[model samples]
Every structure is written in C-alpha cells, then in structure tokens.
Target: MTADDIARWFGEMDAELGGATLFLNETERQLVCSRKLFERRDVRYLDMRADFDQLSDRQVLDLTKPIPRVQSVPVMALMVAMYLGFKEIYLLGVDHDHFITGTYVYAFDLKAQRGKDDSVSSSGEILTSRHDDFQSLARLWRQYRVLREIAAANDVQILNATPGGVLDEFPRVDLDAALSGR
Candidate 1:
C-alpha cells in the first residue's frame, strides 16, 4: 500500500505524527510536514500536546470532536508509528545536518514571551509549538549521534530522501519501486 494509504489504515488525522516528522509544527500553524507526508492526505490540526489513546475510533476531526494526538518528541511519534502497522517508515526530509548543525529550519525568540501563563486558555496552547533551540551545536551533534546510534542498534531502517548529505549510513532503497510495491 502507498505510505499515505498505510497511514490511513494505521491512524486518522488526529493520530500521532512521529517526532522526527514534525516540521514547522505549531498549534497555530497548519503547516504540512514534509517528513510526515500523511498530514498531506488531509487537513491536520496542530495540537501542542500528546493526548494518548484519548480519541475514540469513530471520532472525526472537527470543532467539537478533535483528534487527541498532539505534538510530541520524535521518539514518541516513532513509537506510535510502530503500532500503526507501518512496516517501513520512509522519511522524505530526514535532514540530520539541518538540526545537528546550528542551522535549524527556522528560528524564534522564546524569551520574548517569558511570562505568558497557560492556565485557562485552551486555544492559546502552543503544541510542541517550538523545539528547544540548543545553544551548543556541539551538544546537538552529540545528541544526534546518540539518536543515530539508537536507530542503528534497533535496526529500524531509515531512508533519507534528500539525495544529499550522509545517506550511506542507512540502507538505500529504490523509492519508486517501493511505493509501487514492485
């Protein structure tokens, strides 16, 4: 089945998108994550938190009935995908260098809104709104190494779609054939 099709079989729009896949994700942003291509299958809502099994099977995405799955760390999303019956997780924008290095996809000033309290407002909640901007690129590189090592140790095959950067680290695949199930 197509990756998108597989996604539908596994989870609905309110389900989790693996952490590695939340690109430009914010509670207020309806941005489509290139890595988690399933969001493109239909419109998705940015939830700033992970609700975990709170959504009913028959639930629909709307004003009253919302999908409980929210923005979470990459590992959380990956774990959820494992349960979704996806045999192979194809990554389209697994650009490690972008994060491992100092050049994150985008930047924002968190300190600007230092004292904003989220007590009564539900709509104001920012899903994982923004990732922690690591001050030390070197530290991020170390964390990245650990993440890669964990993936390698687990033998969960990751295919990088950028066609550049360090791809030889993971098993390469003829994506077209895989998509066609050839």
Candidate 2:
C-alpha cells in the first residue's frame, strides 16, 4: 500500500487523533524546519508527547528494521516517522554537524548512515535566527546529505525547507498540497 493508503488505514485505527500531521524529530532544527514545511492546523508532535514507536508499532514492525551499525538521532527519528505512516516525513533541522570530527563521516549513505550515535547535524534554518549557533552548522549539513538518499526509496519525501538552500542532493517538497489534507 502507498503512504496515503497507510494513512487512511491508520486513520481508522481507534488510537488516532483525527487526521493529524505529526512532527517527529529532535529539538533545534528538525522542529523548526518541519513546522515550516509540514504546515497544518493540527501539527502534533512525537518527541515528548508520544514516542512514535510506541504510538503505533504494530503498523510498522514490518517496515522499520534496526540498522545494525547506524545510530543518528535524526535518522532514528525519521524511522519513527515512517513507522507512523508519515510518508512525506521531513527532516527539518537535521543538519549533520557532529559527524565532521570524524574522517569516516563521508561514509554516510542515504539508506543506512554509518554514524555511531544521534549526533548527526542541524538544518540551520531555525538556528539561522540564533547567530551564536552558527559554529554548529557543519553537522546539520552532513545530515541532510545522507538522509536525502535514505528517504528517496522509502516513499518518504525528505526536503531541506530552508528559504534558499540548494540541496544538490535532495528534492524540494511542495507543502502547499500535502498539508491541504486533500
């Protein structure tokens, strides 16, 4: 079934909160970027409110497989989003800043990144408003790079959503239509 089809099925489940758009990610960038891109009236969150995995696992046990050696918080969050039927899941502020200190960071691929932990990167969009955080831009950049590839094949649409970022690797998402609940 397609993402929309899954969404429709999930909607019928008793635990759903209407036809809501959920924000599943960490603080800093993903929160800011997802909010901007996945703009909708009932933008629910999965961070503290509800663990995406726990929210609906029976629906995704078949989809989310544990990445053996991969460990990025943004990527993990992305996995959770996918589990919850969020096909068009956007990694808003997921900039790959923390990976730069390591030389093998370049080994990160889209489907399965090679990082040791959740310290990926930031999107720098929301951080744009906070100048002091400028020093942390590199990590977030790398995150966008690897995440772009993983998201492509999964039927999930990952976009940068920054005002003017090129994202030579990822595609820009059209939020206008997706958020309309059409």
lDDT of 1 by residue, 89-179 (tens): 6655444444333333312222223234332123333222225433333343443333344455555545544445443444556667767
Error of 1 at 108 (Å): 14
Q: After TM-score superposition, what is the CA distance of residue 60 in candidate 2 from its true location, in Å?
A: 8.8
Candidate 2's residue-wise lDDT over 24-134, tens digit each?
A: 333323534533433433443333323222332223323333231223455556555666667676545443442232311332232222222233332212213234333
- 99, model 2: CA deviation in Å? 8.6
Residue 74: error of model 1 in Å? 4.9
Clash numbers, per candidate: 3, 23
lDDT at residue 93 of model 1 (Cα atoms): 48
User: Candidates' TM-scores?
Assistant: 0.32, 0.31
Candidate 2, residue 127: the lDDT equals: 15
* Model 1: worst 10 consecutive residues (lDDT sum): 58-67
Using alpha carbons, what is the TM-score of model 1?
A: 0.32
What is the lDDT of every predicted structure here? 0.40, 0.41
